[model samples]
Target: MTLDTWTTRLSRSLLVNGLPREYVCRTTREMADHLEDMRDSEGDDDASRRLGDPDTLAQMLTHGFRRQSLFGRHPFLTFWLSPIPIATFLAHIVYLFTIELIMPVVVRLYGESEVAFVSGSLDATKVVLVLAMHLWLQAIPVLLTMRLYRIIASRAARPWTSIIPAMILFLLYFSMTKFELTWPSGTNPGNYRIDIGTVSGFSSQPVTQGLQALFVALVCILWLYRVAGEQSSERESAVTAIP
Candidate 1:
């Protein structure tokens, strides 16, 4: 099949699988083409092999997109180039409940007790560094998503109202998983405790946490709805203005 044909089919496939169609067409199609070319090159020596089988080609293309590490010349590129709206509604719902709700609640319930620590300048510096990492981790995904929205739909530029919700959701997830993973593994001296407990919950009470998280999630959903509306309107206006 021709390159355009393959891209169009693959684009449709991704859409059916719940990715945003326009984005897969614009951002990911080129990568698919490139991977196809690489596979063709590799398969050139095998005269009997069909290099462009659609099923195999699609799998390779999707894998490349997922495994792409945007270091070196394209440092930090994945944040923008990720397949947007990549998850199905069911998958997103599952993620929301497990990562955003259940895990955070579990971590907070079991991990918040006080622990003894040594006092020193080194310890203080370690604490600061860990806190900084947590802050950056929380901020990067939201900031990147906003930046991607601007790049993808430039005409619909507006501050993302979804950030508050994503943040709240992340905090819920963060509180549950952070310390349980970061605590020191042994009685090693001069070590800092990267406790998940340090992450303040949305609220101490589970019910209160859920309510606050829901508010943030509502803000996010509304913002996303507005964004989709603005993009659609912009596209319509452009089409009307076309000669």
Candidate 2:
């Protein structure tokens, strides 16, 4: 086949492979005009050359089309290439260690001034309960990351777009929970209260928590989106360059 024909064929295949099965034929057809235009461009010859051979082109098309990991790839590379799952797992661990273990001990050690302002023994109990709730909240993102990874791995779809929806969900959940936790005097039901006598600081603890969650979630989302966009764009550029 001519280089132009190969360019059109391979680009179409890649676009098709990068989409879900149900969208495969649709995506292929949608890309046909663009791929043909790419072939007609003066740069098409150079672009087709980079695709290597039929075997390599086929492998690229098949990649992420299946739900399995690329066999024999380096484990270290996978961690970097697919960092979402690892990051999610680490976030859960931090939540457990900080809230379940560290925060309670710190609360006990520093007196009420060092901790969130709560009223009576109920404050202490609420603190514990709130911490637990926070930990549970983190699981949402972790689960989202896992689902995102599976979708990208299976369909070769852009994972970065997935982060956008996940982040929207995260922000909404945190906002709702923060409001719920704060309105009741920033106290949740639990074993003990804040020992109102030891309290200081006029800050609204619930608001602080909410703002913190918002900041962190926003940062994560933005960073993920930028990275995903960059990588996706680079793939498209590569396809265009190969002739």
Question: Which candidate has the top score in TM-score?
Answer: 2
Q: What digit string (tens of lDDT, one per residue) describes model 1 on residues 129-156?
A: 5445444433333344444434433222
Candidate 2 residue-wise lDDT at 213 = 58
For residue 138, model 2's alpha carbon misses the true position, in angstroms, by 7.0
* Residue pairs that clash (backbone atoms under 3 angstroms), model 1: 104-176, 179-196
Report the Cα lDDT for residue 194, model 2. 21
Q: Give the lDDT of residue 42 in candidate 2.
A: 46
Candidate 1: C-alpha lDDT: 0.41
* Candidate 2: count of backbone clashes, pairs at least 3 residues apart or interchain: 16
For model 2 the TM-score comes to 0.37
**Reference-based TM-score, model 1:** 0.29
Candidate 2 overall Cα lDDT vs. reference? Answer: 0.47
Which regions of candidate 1 deviate over 4 angstroms? 1-7, 11-51, 65-67, 70-208, 223-243
